[model samples]
Target: MIQRIQTIYLLIASIVSGGLIFVFNLWKTLKEQIFVLDLFEEGLFTLNVVPFMFITSSILSLVTIFLYKNRKLQFVIGRIIILMNLFLLGLLIYLSLTLSGETIVSEKGIGMFLPILVVLLIVLANKAIKKDEDLVKSVDRLR
Candidate 1:
């Protein structure tokens, strides 16, 4: 289970969703204050869901890594994570666009793009999991 290629992909996703957020700033304000999901000020109240989603996705990725015995469930969870990340990406984009022109938030950071990367990694992991599931089904049919 741990030896599977999906394990590696999930691990990387965990790092991106959990660890990288602290290191990467989400956006810069006019006062030169860099903000991350968790470090946002009071004015960023509307975007509070960002932190919760990131943490949830990170935890889900880790949980999926251990449920290697259930490939179908793992694949489903992967799909959930992908959708969550895509929603996060869209939210970030919409917020950035609405706040355009350096009024409050300006110059989006690399962190805004991290969801795309996580989505890609999760997709690859899901593909691998699906491949494993298909191989198992094929073997079971031989019996």
Candidate 2:
């Protein structure tokens, strides 16, 4: 179970959502002075939700990894995590686009893309889980 490729994928997804988010800034603002905004720092009210979403996604990934025996459930949870990441990605895009007035967002940070990475990892994990399920079903048919 723990040795499965899906487990590894889920673990990496958790790490990306939980650990890497703090290491990178989300965006830079050029309002007389240039400064970076990490997930915790408040920019837009909606942007504040990003950190919470990341934490939730990380927890969900960890939970899904442990549900390896139930491949169908694991796959379902992975889909939920993917949707969560998609929501976060949309919010990030909204924040970047709506930045107004003196504070023009000069650049988007690598952290802004973390959700996309998480989504990709979750998708891979789900694919692996599906493969495992199919294998189990085929083995049952042989018996």
Candidate 3:
């Protein structure tokens, strides 16, 4: 149901991946320039994928939330979302580390860690979904 704990987690995950990304700066360049890392900015090679991945992750989470009647499918989608977030996290780490000592990126912003938070929330949602599935199976067995 919509009031389930996993639904709340998925909603938060969607908000973090979709909305909060625009609100926070990902990193600052050595030139004191800020990079928000949204879909519109088309400069860096690695960054181009960030926005796409974030949007995909957010969409996946939102879709998974509504698949509550099909717990197995929902769980699988959650796993895919986790993998996407992990890939995004890896890409962000690579970009930050590679650019840190360069003249382009001098400082990383708090938004750089937003994907990590998204991953954590998705995992929690998956766990709760699993628990619900188990509870359902147990009730079926009792009947």
Candidate 4:
């Protein structure tokens, strides 16, 4: 079960979300690079929503990997991860627009694209899960 293709997809998704997160900068300012924590230096609670979502998505992907015994549930969780990534992508776009200022002259980072990749990975996992479910149903019909 652990050796299934969907497990590999989920593992890669988790690695992308959890591991690659820190390797890339979210965005850069004229004054400094990201991971600067300047957004939080002002002591605002509403900041850092993107990083939080990323961590949540990573955890969900990891959890989904272990639910191989329940294909239906695993498929549902995969859908949830897709929706989460979509939401994260939307939020990232919005924030980038706002952060660019009225002149729209800030550099966007590659990290923003991570959500799209995650969504793709989750969809592949869901597809594999569905295929597994269909196989099980076919075998049951044979009996």
Candidate 5:
């Protein structure tokens, strides 16, 4: 049961995060310019939600591995993993933004692949989450 709940949380977070990338891309297309790599350069973007997402995602991923091994509170652990992933992604976007001396870079040349990569990672994580859930259930049944 715990494993199942964790799996659900992972799936939900993955789906939401993946969906958001698409939505953000659409919004970017409609806008005149997009800020891609502001976080790495200016550091202002780091102050926003992006940094939290990166830190949380990294910690959660590591912690989830331990939790899974110990058969601990899987759901909470999974949520943390998902949140961490989201934050990492947010950070990636923030870092990808390019800026000039006093102006932000134009959006015309922004590559589409980075966002796609982020979505791909989320999808893969969701698949792994399902696999983990299955493994946990099998072990539970054996016990």
Candidate 6:
């Protein structure tokens, strides 16, 4: 079913994103004591944000899948969750920008791109869920 497909896509995205975060965190901790990449020196504290976002995203994605599976009809709860996620993301970005200061630096860098990618992935997942609901509604109307 369309719902199942959407759920699967969400699951994969969550797992991949979460795995990346876990790995990044692990690496940070492991190399914290060692003088490694100079890249780590700049804004290393910001790296802490990555794991939290990914883990939260993963948990939300899993919860959404389970909720969809059990609900026979479209539920507003999923949309609420998605909205809350967007709010949380916005807060994180605001915090980052405030802390990073007013620099006209390039916004196309990986640090900027990562958060944008995560937001895009979640938005797409939400769209897929909406599509599934629309399909169910169409089928219900025929029956």
Show pairs that collide, candidate 5: 36-96, 36-97, 37-95, 37-96, 37-97, 37-98, 53-87, 54-87, 56-84, 57-84
Q: Model 3 compared with the native: what TM-score?
A: 0.89
Give the poorly placed runs of model 4, Cα more than 4 Å off: 35-46, 100-104
CA lDDT of every candidate: 0.88, 0.83, 0.86, 0.82, 0.45, 0.51
Per-residue lDDT over 2-106 for candidate 3, one digit per residue giving the tens place of the 0 to 100 score: 899999999999999998987787777655545445535767667788888998999999998889899999999999998998999899888777664485437
Could you tell me how far off, in angstroms, the CA of residue 76 lies in candidate 5 after the best superposition?
Answer: 4.5
The better-scoring model by lDDT among 2 and 5 is: 2
Q: Which candidate is the best by lDDT?
A: 1
Sorted on TM-score, best first, the list reads 1, 4, 3, 2, 6, 5
- TM-score, every prediction: 0.90, 0.88, 0.89, 0.90, 0.38, 0.54
Give the lDDT ranking, best first: 1, 3, 2, 4, 6, 5
lDDT of 6 by residue, 92-143 (tens): 4654455433343323223323334555655676677777677778999999
Q: Per-residue lDDT for 112 in model 1?
A: 91
Q: Residues 67-141, candidate 1, lDDT per residue (tens digit)?
A: 999999999999999999999999888877776456554667889998999999999999999999999999999
Give the per-residue Cα lDDT of candidate 6 at 99. 40
Estimate the overall C-alpha local distance difference test score of candidate 1. Answer: 0.88
Task: Say which prediction, candidate 2 or candidate 4, comes out ahead on TM-score.
Answer: 4
Model 1 stretches with alpha carbons more than 4 Å out: 38-40, 43-45
RMSD per candidate (Å) reads 2.0, 2.7, 2.1, 2.2, 9.0, 6.9
Specify the poorest-scoring 10-residue window by lDDT in model 2. Answer: 31-40
